[model samples]
Target: MNLDELDAALRREFTGAEAERRVVVRQAGDLADTEKAETDRGVPLTVDEIVDNLSDAPDEGVASRWNWWMGALEAAYGGYEPFQVRRIPKE
Candidate 1:
């Protein structure tokens, strides 16, 4: 889907902190962590899933990239995956 469609989907699917977190993170490369976002379009996981992966990931850099949990989300997610929500819009 295009950026607008993705935004609508995100808006419909999430709100508040959850939605905000998705907006902050910038994904790139591949979502090797989870299948939530795996599809013809790209990763489809929610903000919660992303945060979980980040927390579980062996690397800490992923969580250190941004002012995580600033507002939209309230937890950590691994460094942005290429197929992540934030990255898809730019594509």
Candidate 2:
């Protein structure tokens, strides 16, 4: 699913607490590239810094957001492809 669809699904399927946590996790995952860039530059990154960077990043395209959400979901749930998703609880 695309990012907008995924966001809507998360809102629908998750309670307030779970939705908040999902946002945190997704934001963290989104910072992966920025974190790598910082590491390459020999700069240390605090959690807040990473989070802020992620928050400021562009989310203009459905395709980019889809990839981001898929990667985050895969890392959290252990696979990107739906067929590879085990008997985990839907989130």
Q: Pick by lDDT: which candidate is best?
A: 2
> What is each predicted model's overall lDDT from 0 to 1?
0.37, 0.41
- Evaluate model 2: give its lDDT: 0.41
TM value for model 2: 0.28
Off by more than 4 A, model 2: 1-38, 59-89
Per-candidate TM equals 0.28, 0.28
lDDT of 1 by residue, 9-75 (tens): 4344433343343443433112324343344226455654445444443432432322232212222
Please report how far candidate 2 places residue 64 from its true position, in Å. 7.0
Tens-digit per-residue lDDT, 1-91, candidate 2 = 1334435543443334444545534543454434543454365544444333334435533233334544554575544534221222337
Indicate the TM-score of model 1: 0.28
Please give the lDDT score at residue 3 for candidate 1. 39
Candidate 2, position 1, lDDT: 14
lDDT of 1 at 19: 36
